[model samples]
Target chain A: MLALAFQLARRDLRSRYLGSFSGGAWALLQPLVQLAVYAFVFGYIFRQRLPGADAPGYVPFLVVVMWPWTAFAEAVSRGTTAIQDNASLIGKVALPRAALVLAPVMASFAIHGIGFLGLLLVMLLAGAGLAPAGLALMLPALALLFLFALGLALLLSALQVFVRDIAPALPQILMLWMFLSPVFYGRYVMPEWVRPWFDLNPMTGFAEYLRYALLNMPAPGLRAMACSVGAVVLVLALGLFAFRRLQRHFEDFL
Target chain B: MSVLVEAHGLGKSYPRVFRRSDRFRSLCSLLAGRASGEVTPVLQGIDLCVPRGQSLGLIGDNGAGKSTLLKLLTGVLTPTHGSVRVNGRVGALLELGAGFHPEYTGRDNIAMAATLQGFSADDLAARLADIVAFADIGRYIDEPVKHYSSGMVVRLGFAIVAATRPDLLITDEVLAVGDESFQKKCIRWMEDYLEQGGTLILVSHSMYHIQKLCRQALWLREGRMQASGDVFEVTQAYLAHHERKSAADEARARDLDAVRGLEFHVRAMRVNGEEAETLPAVEQGAALTVEATIASRDGRVPVVNVGFARADGTPVYGVSSDMDGVQPAPLPDGDFRIVLHIAELPLLPASYTIRVHPLDSEGLRLFDTVERTLTVKGRSSESGLVRLAHVWEHAAPLSRSRGE
Candidate 1:
């Protein structure tokens, strides 16, 4: 099953940019361009600043959280349509159906993860006040974020096969979710009452952990960590349950 | 012998989704772990057991659920009732392109298909050259699959399946798309595969191919198994049904009341002591006696002609009483009776019709005709409408094979 998933992911990645002139380079460049646009809008136009004089520049703060968020959002959105997109394949070939959903999530993470690593290396060399050791420290947090995205992906993709409303509505939902979390700004800037509530959104722990690890910022509270971990476990359980239950009937509906 | 495929009471049905709301309703029902409310059953109660090394042909008309059964056996569609158990690796070519991606090159799709068949990268690398050679599509291997002709697609699909060398091969009328040479190559390969104890399930409209490749056959009609047995019997029955169906369509156009007004018309005809329009199936080479009575309105003698034709209206032979220098015996009511008897019927096992026409005494002006359907039943695989008398001379026949 794992080998099948890997093969499908490779195919998905290659076919996505198959006809393009730049080919796979666009996987990294697209994220970079998105980052540049966000940087210009927030860093230059809005002049957004992090709290405290010692806090990292707004661009670095956004950079740390933005890439992981992009990976998560893209993984979920693409994965949601995975089963529907491969309706032809599912009806014709008898293989593990979950591998179809897993492929897109794996491809999204692989592409954005590389872009994130390259940008971090460039920043470290530019003397951007990044904790070089924190790069190593963030590996565990990154792994958890991947599971979180995968959990949601499995759930949404299965639902998309039946409902079909999930895919079209997912972008708006992710945008609202990003705003609710601390992707563009720090939880510290929110009012105190709302700051504590940020713990409920799973992305909060992921964003704050990246900032704390790479930018030498404050760590997420123990309650926030527990909440995010709990959410991931719960979502993973629900997602697996829903996906396994619905996978058998996918061909009938499709 | 070990059984390679077993299916019991297997059936399939599609959810009835006439409206958008029905799809939603079905989704809700399915998610709730309940059966959908409405469905159109396409197949039902199909029981099959194919032992290892057996080649079974699936023969049926269009929309008779042959393709659906193939998909069910291949595990592409889950059975709605009972179960199917296949104890070996199965490779299926269910449709034209075998589910290939149109945008991908043939080489790329080959790799993906091989992976789907559970071949590791190392295994595929070893067989890559063999697959390309078997497909024999030349430079089109590098072109996108959508750009390839339909025949080329089947060639590539069959080549990959051949490379896999699965334990059980299931194909659905895909060979009809290929050109003659490619088709011959596929048949040769399949024959070699079957020779090595491989199991096969084939679907084709061509009975010649079915009889040539399969030893056992199953005939499906309107989603039900019409007959299942030795290849010759089932295929011959399927063909006879079609022939009778077409002949009946033409028979409906001729009204008996209209023919009764003619000056010389056929009054009654009987085949082998049966007077019905469709006589019971007779064994090949059995004696056949055709008797006809013609009515003449002016008390004049009439010529009786007996003609044999395949049910599809292909005339086989015709003989007139006048041509043989014989006259029909006159009855008390001025009608004439003639009997034509064949001591050993030469007709092969298929559906045929015997027509008796009444003509004026000169045998030139035909008045009316009547046809009776005859079905010859046997296990013979001989081709053509009639068997010819021949003898083999100076033939060597002393060799014996170990398996036999």
Candidate 2:
């Protein structure tokens, strides 16, 4: 099953970029451009600054939080429609059903990894000198973000087969979701009443975890990390249950 | 031989949703413990077993659940009830090129499919050359599958399946496509595969191929098994049923035209001066005659036409009284008797139908028709609908060549 999953992901990655002249370089282009836009709008135009952030500039602060955010958002949004798009393969081949959901997540993870490394290189060249301990802390945060996205994707990909509204409505939902999380703006800027609600959004811990790791900001406390992990586990459990139940009739529906 | 597949009481039903909103409603209701749409039951109560090294043929008309049954056996669609236990690995060609990605080249698609079929990377690398040689779609193997013709796509699909070499192979109507040469190549490969102890379940509409390839046959009609037995017996029964159905249809068409408007009516038809209600048997190349008596409403002489047709409704020959410039003779009873004659009928040993058409004076328009089915019995071992008379001559005497 792992072999098949790897093959499908590799094929998807290759074909995705093969259509353009720049090939795999195009995968890095979109995120880099989006990063530039955020830097211009939030850093220069609005002149935004984090209240308790140890980082000096808004662009680095935003990049630290938004890199992982981009991966999470893209994986969930694209993963929702992954099963529906591969209805042909589902109906024809007897494959491990989870492979379809995991392929998009894995592909997005690779692209995001490259973009994050590029940003880190630029930040180091600009002399931020991010600490090694904080850099090591980013690994666990990355894993949590991946787990959350995979869980959401599995649940939604199965539901999207029956309720097609999920696919079309997800991007709009994710847009609202990104705003609710501490993506461009830090949680410190939110009104105190809304600050607690940010903890309820699982992405809050993921974003803060990244910010603390790369910018030496205040780290997510153990309680907040526990809440996030608890939510991720719950979603993962429910997602697997629903996905396994619904996949039995996938061929009929497809 | 061990049994490779055993399916009992298997069934499949698809819910019919007329609108997109209805599908949504059904999904909502299904979660709420209530059913919402009409269900179409496609197959039910199918019991079948295919043993190792034995080929089974699924023969049926369109919408007879043949394809559905194949899908169930291959586990593409879970059955609604009952059990299906298939032993050993299975390779299926359910729909030609169904799993192929349009944007991917044939070579890339092969690797993907082979991996899905449980081939390790090293194993696939080892067998890749054999698959490419079998497909033989040169140059196009590196091109995207969307650019391939339908035949090329089938070649690539079959090649991948063949590379896996599962214990049992299931195919549904995919052979009907592709050029004759490719089809022959596939058949030869299948024959060799069976010889090497591979089980096969083949679904097709062609009886001749089924009889040649399969040891057992299952005939389905309207989601039910019509017959299951040795290949010869089941196929013969199916063919005989088909013949009876077409003959009834021909009879119905004749009866419908007999009462149409009644400007001209055919009273009686006689074969070889002997009147009969049904078709009469005749020897091949024997003298035959068809005499028809017709009654005209205005006492105007009407043209009578005679036609010969094969049992399958293909027109063989037709000649009208007006076409031959022969005028119908008026009888004393206010009717005309038209006679069509043949010194020697040139039909092969098969059943045929002779039809008569009554037209108004000129054969420009037909008013009524009557027909009789004839069985031409003969000792000649000829094939096809008609037998042409010819003498065989030796190009060079066989004895001279042998002596040399």
Candidate 3:
């Protein structure tokens, strides 16, 4: 099943990159360009810093949260119709349904890799040394990212075959989720009254952990990372559960 | 040895029907009383089983639930009613090129296809070369599949599944693809697989292929099993039923035209053409003759026309009495026999209707009615449209040429 997922993901990657200049390079280019403009406008013009200011530079600050957020959103939207988009295959071939859901997740992971490297370079350029603690946490952070993607991918892709409206509705919904995620600023930047709320949010802990990893910052902590991982598992399980329940009806509806 | 697949009361209903009824009902419920309509059931109570190593052929006319049954068997479309169980893995050519990515190379797609069909990474690695060679697109294997032709796509697709070697192979019309040579190759490969103890379940229109391949055949009518038994018996019955229906149709058509005036007109016809003389029933080649008669009017005269239309309205030739009537004389008062002489009939054994028209000397139409179905019952085109004299020769440069 893993081999199938990767193979399908490779097809998607080839399709998106084959005709463009610097094939496969666009994955990094998109996130890098966005980071550069944000860093210049906010850090240079506004003369601002990270929410904690003590943690890292603004470019890394934005990237740490932006990468995972973008990955989550992309996985949900693309994975939404992953099966229906290949309705012939789903209807004709006997393949593991799980692989179809995970295909987009693999593609998103490709982009996340590029975005992460771009963030690392930007942080170094800003005179922030790489954080050892941040490096140590990259593995867990990646697991969390994949977990969140799997959950949303399964839920959205399965429904996409039936509802169809879900694909068009994703961008608007994901846009709302972006602002709500603390990607632009830090959890500390939010009002103290809502600090507890940000802590509870799955996106908040993820951002803090990623930043803490790259800049050698202090502990983003075991409790926060554990909470995010737990939420990831719960979401994935529920999403897959929903997907299987709806899968049998896909052929008629698709 | 064992039942490989079985379906009990398997059923499926497309949502299009329910959505349609919802519209009618919602209208009534909104404006007045509750509305209702019957939902169309696409499949109902389908029960079938194929034991291990058995080759099953499904035969049905269009819209008889054949495709639906195949879909359910392959697990593409789930049954809305009973559960389905299969003991082993299934490889299917359900929709040709279903998993092919237009932008990916043939090699890449082979790996992806194999994996999707349940092969492991190592398994694909081992079968990679064999898959490419089987596709027969030598140098283009590295190119993106979108650049490949439709035939190439099937070659690659068939190659991939053949390599996967699933426990059961379920194929629809994938065999009816590409050129004749490719079809022969695929059939031979399938036969080899069967010899190796692999199972096959096929749905096709080629009665000859099915009769030869399947020991037993199934006949489906309106989503129900009409017959399931020996291939020869079932297929013959199916053909006979259609033939009978067509014959009855021809009879009704003749009756409809029977209402025309026989006096001073063309009456009933047998062959629609008649030769002045008759020939032997058993001869070197079969000859078709059209015979007809015109009732002479007391004062008025008419020149009639005769012609033949191929099975599909293709006009063969037409002869009119217009040229014969240029002297202002009507056809003979009684009957006239027009014979179309042919040493051999070129058409295969199939049904074709004949046409007879009535006209004047100036080619002005008087009356025309098509009648007489000419059924050419022959095994091959050797009993051809025209008789020909020919010889066969073999030449050798070092020796001499000989003709027979």
Number of the candidate with higher lDDT, 1 or 2: 1
Best-fitting candidate, measured by lDDT?
1
> Can you write out model 1's per-residue Cα lDDT over B36-145, one digit (the tens) per residue?
88888899999999999999999998999999898888888888887999999999999988679998899989998888899999999999999999999999999999
iRMSD in angstroms, per model: 1.6, 2.2, 7.7
Which docking category, incorrect, acceptable, medium or high, applies to candidate 3? acceptable
lDDT of 1 by residue, A37-59 (tens): 87776666655463431334766
Per-residue lDDT tens digits of candidate 2, residues A2-45? 88878988998898888789998877888778878877766666
Ranking by DockQ: 1, 2, 3
* Top of the candidates by TM-score: 1
Ranking by lDDT: 1, 2, 3
Which ranges in model 1 have alpha carbons more than 4 Å from their true place? A48-57, A125-129, B252-268, B293-302, B328-338, B358-361, B364-370, B390-404
What TM-score quantifies how close candidate 1 is to the native fold? 0.92
